[model samples]
Target: MSTTTLLRSRPSRPLKGGGVSRTSPLKPRRSRLLTGMMLLYLVYTLVPLLWLLLSATKTQDDLLSSPGLWFGKTFALFSNIQDTLTYDDGIFLRWLGNTLLYVVVGAGGATLLATAAGYGLAKYKFAGRRAVFAVLLGAVAVPGTALAVPTFLMFSNLGLTNTVWAIIIPSLVSPFGLYLMWVYASDAIPHDLLEAARIDGAGEIRIFFTVALRLLVPGVVTVLLFAVVATWNNYFLPLIMLSKPNLYPLTVGLTQWSNQATGVGARPIYNLVITGSLLTIVPLVIAFLFLQRFWQSGLSAGSVKQ
Candidate 1:
């Protein structure tokens, strides 16, 4: 075979109406309007955070005197932190401990329950499964606030009001977490894999632990983060349930500090309040940073079919 004959016999590429090559790749056009809007949004989001960071470093007078985006003359950040920790007999530390306790027990329990329930719902076939799903959807739609009054009344009847159980108990029920895990598990864990484990004399529980659990890591982490954030940021439920100042979480405790600025004989602790608010969000930021990879994977899992 000659080179000329080989070249002449090769297939020709198709063209569009005006003879433009169909196989040619076109670069995506960038929209300046969208880029400018995004820049504006970035400024809007960062400005508040910058203001908070700068404000937390100032004394009460300096906070009021200094421009929001700029630092004050005397940097009192360390002193402000000391004051926040030591003020009112170190109640901030107590609130911190309480918040940790709630997050660990409530959020942790919620995740465990959600994982198990979601996995079971995804894999198992039993009576009333559709009903269970319907109930879950209904529960998810009903905001927590709507259930608060009834929950309070029930807790009051049981003499459980103002106790840690009041907060921890309610935090364990995460309908959204369950729903998310169910959806993730249905696709992520193959039915054939589970059946193979069973054929090899592995019990259902053993199979789930050794086989399905590994595939469910991203989904589990995603549910856990959601539960953690929800339980950590819970405000109204704890506010209405617990009247004891010592039992308060950081959310309610910080609000109390913020309110000290108003009314007669008010002691304005703006410096501590600002500093405390900064402290409050640090753990959440850390959580997102650490678990972000798993979170992103979980979100994108079912997007493309294998």
Candidate 2:
């Protein structure tokens, strides 16, 4: 511990022929900067989410006047939840159920369809394949909102207006999902494996379902997550397609409550709307957390393979 002993213990010479090493000094500063930026980013993204959560626990007056993060003295978290659930003959529950139905059916169907289509595109070299892929690429860039009116008109002509199919049909055709699957399938699955399977007498369909399917679980999870969230949060399409309150998704139902809050005669449903919004996000949060491992592996696989 003495000064002379400490001096003797130090490096005998520079790592590279008397050239001073810059690694230590640069690493700490770079680490500090990265940590600080990450902390800032977390606060930036989470502050609004936290504010929404706190706002939900308070009454309407408390929401407007109280400090954003602090809870009001009277904890009405339960009361607000009750109001959210009970409002308008428990229509919120109906909307929640409808939202789940849409997400499960639409996203499930889309994921299945997209996976099959993408696998084929990536594995096979058929005529017009390039053109088909090009069309999907163009569709990926097209904003889905742009198709709402056209979709509405088409569904209306077929007597599908005000029905769930109007929303479900649109949700099925996710160009981005197909693109993701194409990229993932091409990169992750080996052509040699398919040839081996063929030599073993496995049919194309059987080979895909058995051999490639397990390998593609990560990509499937990614597709399911996006498809589910997109369908769950779809508001504009449903707004134009379905007019029935019973068919409304959570997003539409929340908007209706928000509108009611603005009305002069009705007691402001701001508290209920905020509370509903908070509850609405719970399913998505739970799903993402549950699938975190899958998504992490999928992304890492993409990076490592590249």
Query: TM-score winner among the candidates?
Result: 1
Q: Could you list the CA RMSD of all candidates, in the order they appear?
A: 8.8, 8.1
Stretches off by above 4 angstroms in model 1 are 1-33, 304-306
User: 136-167 in candidate 2: lDDT tens per residue?
Assistant: 77887787778778878888999999988988
Q: What's the TM-score of every candidate structure?
A: 0.88, 0.87
Per-residue lDDT of candidate 1, residues 1-306 (tens digit): 344333333324222246454444632357799999999999998898889989989999998888888999899999999999999999999999999999999999998898889999999999999999888788878877999999999999999999999999999988888888898889998899988888899998898788988888888898889898998899999999999999999999999999999998898899999999999988899988888755665565555444
